[model samples]
Target: MSKTIQMPALSPTMEEGTLAKWLVKEGDTVSSGDLLAEIETDKATMEFEAVDEGVVAKILVAEGSEGVKVGTVIAIIAEEGEDVAAAAAGGGAPAPKADPIPAKSEAEAPAAKADVIPAKAPPAAADNRVKASPLARRLAEAKGVDLSAVAGSGPNGRVVKADLEGAAPAAKPATPATAAPAPAASASTPAPVAAAAQDFGIPHEVIKLSGMRKTIARRLTESKQQVPHIYLTVDVQLDKLLKLRSELNAGLASRNVKLSVNDLLIKALGVALIQVPECNVQFAGDQMLAFKRADISVAVSIPGGLITPIVTGADSMGVAAISTAMKDLAARAKDGKLAPQEYQGGTASLSNMGMFGIKQFEAVINPPQGMIMAIGAGDRRPYVVDDSLQIATVMSATGSFDHRAIDGADGARLMKAFKELIENPIGMLA
Candidate 1:
């Protein structure tokens, strides 16, 4: 029986994928769980595996093919020894393509050869001391330098411009002077000619935009141009929160775990979201849909793209659980091996550039999610606390809300609750 191998959805946001590489050629043997090809999604390059055993009959999608929608037939598998191409053309069953098999040892591949030069050439004396044109020989004789001593600086190592100039002066070698260094040669020579001023100019390379870059550009452009965004700013004192994180980390470190201030903030946000469920609402067309679970998405940067992997049921997880889950997700994200369930179903997002020293920034809301938080670096600043001027560690968190789901007041109220939670982090443990 012939079977079609359609493109699979590698990620929740992937409507289509690019066939980056095909591991199997036509007529190869395939088995269930064998890797068939590599597909580049919006976030990463994922491996496509064969689910059944068969011979490769035909390849509908070639390597480097793009814009293929999910579930679109890309290849066909045919019966053993069957001609897949002829079968497919005749509207008959196609043959299966072989999946890539991994090599078990380095000996299976040929070793690279080493480059070496043989040393059996004639010695300098017998090799005819020097080869030079008659005119050049005359010039060297006139300059009183041995031709053998001057390496040819011209084409094919032939002596040319300043072979004579580079030769030492004919005077006998002088004795070294033993004295204090005289005023370092007062005359400064012009900086060695500025690398000849690169007439052709420095070369540059042109790279085509990847799928993720394209999506980011399009969405951000639409967001800035169409979405009416309003800004709200509030500073929360973070001295106590910092102390709490340090103490908890000191104790946590004994258990082979470490936590960052961002982790604590994520936990705080999760707690606040439960109390203010309005912030957990999503804009579904004309309706506002609220979610019961607080799935918090944390933005992680992979080599070629950015991905937001979620912490499911974050509202119910403790600070340590949230921290551990986030670390696991981040590690897998960097490795490009995260399953679809790891990245999908986030009700809200948190983007912290504080570790990178960004003071503050406004972020675009991820679609369907009513809000996204942008966090900045915490620094010491002066503020009035009960009519007394004091220095305190403060940080700012800004939320971008979807007006269709959350009103201005609703977003503000959620942010206000978050500010209080982070400011009084001890209350978050409750």
Candidate 2:
């Protein structure tokens, strides 16, 4: 028997991916758990592993093929002693199975009446059932191209991948004044119109967007449009925290553990979320999810885009442990080797631009997560210490909360707790 290997879903939100490379070619023998190919999903480039032992009979999709839909057959594996040529010839798309209809019980069956005529579906409903290839449909969705408006060039007027190339998205219909206004654009919203480029004879290079960059653009646009963001900023003296970090690093010098200012702040945000649980929540339709433990997503900028690698149970982790974990996560994130689970879910997020000398800025809230804490650079400033003029190292921290799930007062309280934790660095350790 031969096994048909279809494209695997690399992540929960992966609809399609690029077959970056093939490790095994036709006629190569592979066993279970052997590396098959490198797939570039929206999040990362992951290695696909084989599950069954067999010889690679054929490769249907070529390397560097983009927009390969999930469950689309990519290759075939012929079992031991099977004719590879025969398997390759017969191993195209699998036959579509007809859905089995269940037999209705006599007591539950509705009475058939000659007078009851079946209602005709509207023209628009019929038009929505446009014939299109899976790749064409996926490309149309990403590019916001309307299949009904596109002129197909394939057999029987079926929409093909080439039909969507350079096709403009359909314009939205105008809404009537009497109708209620639609909500802000969300993840399900169609992609906005792309900005046209004009070089004006200037020498410039046009770089194609990678899968990661496309996902980031779509997600951040949706976040800003749909998520109601409420930013609360507070200035806290970082002198104490800085001093504690120095001492802690000195104590851990023998163990080769060093703590960065951001590590202590991550601990601070995690503990603050624990202290003020109201701020640590997710907004779902009709209900809100209150988290018991804080899983903090730390933002790391890579070549293509930014990624947040989560540090689960950050509240209970020590600064040394947080530093170690963060270092590992950040390195892996930059290498694009993190698993989907490592960057997907979090109770909240933390983004620090202090290394770049950023004074203060508000961060967009990652969807479903309640809030994100943005950290600014710490600098020496004149301040009143015990009612007297003094110099202190202070940093401005801003918390961007989802107004739908968290109240302004709760957000303020979380900021207050974060300030206290940073000021009293010993409490975080305790």
Candidate 3:
């Protein structure tokens, strides 16, 4: 008998993953708790451990294979006294087919093992007729650049976008607003381009999307198209919170705990959610799911896309604790070493682009989560206080809520509660 190893759902939301590497080859024996492979999940790279000890009879999925679906048989292990070759042949099922790319004329180009790696440039053109990609040919024609003059930079003397870097882009001819629309060249639809024509004459490179980027695109597109989002913006005074952070940092300096603005904001949002439970809910097709605990998903931008690492029971964790936890999670996230449990299943999210100096912006909701708070940079601004105008440090925050689950009034109240907590500073702690 053989034991089948299926591609794992590393995160709760993970439907597929990139089989980044195989730590063990065919015929290698692995014990329980041993690291078997590195699986690149939707958010991070996680170590896949062997749960049952056995001899690796076969690997159905190749290393570096992207978009491996969960529950698909990826390998087979021979049980004790079992024939390795027979077990390998008896592997559960064939690898699943990858989801077909959306029918927007597929990019006509040779895809590398991973991202499109630009081939190193050759010393000179190999042939009289310059070998170039369809996109390169179109671009060179449009720009009137001599293809022979550009050196080959892609595999096998092929001229790719990278070779055009020094060349100028073709400018689009102007069209007056009053001009009539041009008709299609043919009555039928155009065939898919092996390489989409690039109107630009300038040399550029097309980097293929990685697994993470693909998932982000699909999820965000679905979020915008399906979710009924209503945004509510509020201006919050941050002077109190700033002071509290400074004082807290000084007191905790000996203990080596430092708090960031985002950490404090995470606490405030968590408390606010608890105060206004009506707003802390998810739309479950038929009804709203009101969560009891406030688990905050703090957005962390990684190499290819953004991920939200959760702080479970954020309402119960102190500001200092949140800071420590967030720092650990963020560092691991960047290194692609986070566990599935560390980054999944949060009630709400908080995205702070303050460090990037963004004034304010709205964030898309992660599916199954009701809301996301977008935080902007805090700076000195004129405000009315005590019947007098004064300069105070203030920031604009926007909340994007799922209208299906949370009403307009509840959304507004959640924003008010968040603002009050930041303004008072002490309310979060209490």
- The local distance difference test score of each candidate is 0.70, 0.81, 0.79
Candidate 3: deviation at residue 170, Å?
A: 23
Candidate 1 ranges beyond 4 A from true positions: 11-13, 81-204
Clashing pairs in 2: none
Give a tens-digit lDDT track for model 1, residues 176-233: 4755453442131111222223223544332345776766677778767756665566
Per-residue CA lDDT of model 2 for 100-127, tens digit only, reads 1111100111111244332232122243
Point to the candidate with the largest TM-score: 2
TM-score of 2: 0.78
With candidate 1 superimposed using the best TM-score fit, by how many Å does residue 391's alpha carbon deviate from the native? 1.9
Model 3: per-residue Cα lDDT over 1-430, one tens digit each: 6888888887767777778899999999999999999998767888899999889998767787665668877788888888898887774534333321111312222233243344454334333345666556655554546666666654555665557667865444457686567554322223223223343234554455677786789889999999999999999989999999999999999989999999999999999999999988999998778899999999999888888889989998988899999999999989988877887789999999999999999999998799999999999999876789999999999999999899999999999999999999897898
lDDT of 2: 0.81
Stretch of 10 with least lDDT, candidate 1: 104-113
Best-to-worst TM-score order: 2, 3, 1
CA deviation > 4 Å runs, candidate 3: 1-3, 52-54, 79-194, 197-200
> Candidate 3's C-alpha lDDT?
0.79
